[model samples]
Target: MNIGFIGLGIMGSGMANNLLKSGFNMYVFNRTREKAKELEDNGAKFCSTPKELAEKSDLIFMMLTDVRACRAVSEDKDGFLESLSKGKVVVNFSTVHPNYSLELREMVKEKEAMFLESPVLGSKIPAQKGELVILSAGDKEAFEICTDAFEKISKKAMYLGDVPKASYVKVVNNEAFATSLTAYLEGLAFAKKIGLDPEMVFNILNSGALSNPYFEFKVKKVLNDDFETHFSFENMKKDLGYALSVADEFKCYCPTLAAVNEIFKKGLNKHAKEDMSAVYKIFDE
Candidate 1:
């Protein structure tokens, strides 16, 4: 398949490399040309802009940062909107608000191309290994056509039936995850405050019912003070904010989660660019 990928940050960079390794004809573009250079050296074609990438490929994947960036890349001057046409497929892997995903679904459909919202659940390592959980939703035919590509990028690709539904599921999923992480942080912090060895606390948690692979993996990082950009605090803040918006839209009562969202924001100024594990620094501070 003729595939194009934009947004070559940590997640996108790994995904693009996997696509190239999987033997797809990959066309890659990043706002910073340097990010695309590695892909170019690996046999992926480089494009100067999203529009140019769109012009050259049948399928385009975008993993931008947030709603604003997603919209800007697909609709701005010299963006992807100008070149989108029939028979094209645009798969969005970014974590964006459901309402924005709905808007883009229509925008691409108007251009006679199909749009799929497939927010992934994994960070740098999982993305690099193609072990992501892809929650995908869109037109059935488009979903079917994307099956091969999806297999190349994720361990599991769920067809969620429609655009905003998959987006909604993603938001809800992150709500649970952010809240869970916050709960972990609170417990760990409380342990240290009470003079319990934090390592011993983690050891107990790892051996108990509360433990899971994800929790253990993250907590081990926390114990070691290793917050080396698996997923940024600012990005977690963005997802929590969107998740809260979804809760509010549905008239759901989530005061604990609401509080957790504010807690995540506490890291924005200091640990904004670091992994979400850096939120632990907030407790220490």
Candidate 2:
């Protein structure tokens, strides 16, 4: 299949490379052309515009930043929708508000094309390793058609049956993660304040019933003070904001999520571009 990928950001670049390595014909585009260089060098066609990319590919995947960027690329003069034809699928890997996913579904439907909200769970490392878990919704037939491509880039691909479901699940997952990470960091800071070694505290936690791979991975970054951007604080903050919006739509009460969102918002003052682990610095402050 001829696959078109837009937004060659941290996660997108890795996922697109896996598809190319899987032997699919790949076309890529990015606002910053330089981001597409590596993929181009790997034999993927680099299209200058979304419209151009869409015209040359059978299925399109977008891993854009937010809802606004997603809309701009799909609706602008040289956008993908301009060249998107019937029977084609457009999968979005970006984390966006579930409501917007519904809108995107309708937008693509209007063009007689199928759409899937397929936000993923994993960061730069897992994406590069082709181990990200894809939670997808919308158009079962389209999901089946893209199974091979999904398998190439992800360890698992789940079809949750319709727009907004997968988006809701992804938003909720990120919300829980933000809250958990904040709690973990706060405990670590408290441990340090009480004259305990932070690394020793992490070691204790890692040996207990609460031990898990995610925390194990993040704790190492925390101990090393590595805030490099596997996933940016700004993006996590954005996802928290999306979670709040989703909760409001469903009339759900989420006081903890609200507080966690504020914590990420505060982190934005200095660590917006750094890894989400940089939130630990807030506790130190």
Candidate 3:
């Protein structure tokens, strides 16, 4: 497959590396052109514009930050829409609004192209290991054709039926993740202030039914005070906002997520560029 990828941030960079290692010829672009330099050095062709990349590839993957970026990439003068061709597939791995995905789907279809919503369920480490979980939706044929690529990028790629369904699933999944992580971190924060060893708190709960591997991995980072950026607080806040939008559209009660969103906002206020784990600082802040 002649493949292209735009956006080379934390998650995107590793995903691009996996695609390159999969032996596909890659066309690449990023607003911060320097971000693509590493991949360009690795034999990926670098393009100046999304349209240029779109024109030259049969498949393009977008791992952008928000709905605005996603829309701009598609509709801007030198964007994806300008060069979209029939039968070409564009797979978006960005966590954005489902309604925006639906609108983009229609725009892509108008050009006889297919748009696949493929929001991922892991951050930098998982992307580096090609172990992210992919929730995909859109044209079944496009999904099938991209299965091999998805295999190279994720541990599992599940096809959910249509454009917005995958987006909806992604937001729901992320909202739950934020809520769960917030509650866990709150416990750790409480343990610290109350003179209990936070590590013991993590160790005890982590040994029980509610345990998850990520809980252990993240606790190590927290204990070490290593708040490097795998997934930034900025991006987490963006996804949290998108998830809340989904909740509102469905008229679903989401007090937990609503409160969680504010917590992430506060985290971003001070440590905007740091990893989401920096939200732990919320206790001290």
Instruction: Report how far off residue 231 is in candidate 3 (Å).
Output: 1.3
List the global CA lDDT of all models.
0.89, 0.92, 0.89
> Candidate 1 or 2, higher TM-score?
2
Best by TM-score: 2
Kindly list the per-residue Cα lDDT of model 1 for residues 3-62, writing each as its tens digit: 999899999999989989999999988889898888899899988788998999999999
Off by over 4 Å in 2: none
lDDT of 1 at 66: 95
Q: Which stretches of candidate 3 lie over 4 Å from their true place?
A: none
For each candidate in turn, the TM-score is: 0.98, 0.98, 0.97
TM value for model 1? 0.98
**Candidate that scores best on lDDT:** 2
Residue 235 deviation, candidate 2, in Å?
A: 0.4
lDDT of 3 by residue, 1-285 (tens): 899998998889999999999899999999999999899999999999999999999998999999888878889889988999999999999988888888889998999998899999999999999999999999999999899999998999999997789988888887887788778888899998999998888888889986998877877898889989888888888989998878888899999999999998877768889888788889744
Ranking by lDDT: 2, 3, 1
Candidate 2 lDDT by residue in tens digits, 36-112? 89889989998989999999999999999999999888999899999988999999999998888999899899989
Show the lowest summed lDDT stretch of 10 residues, model 3. 276-285
lDDT of 1: 0.89
What's the lDDT for residue 283 in model 3? Answer: 76
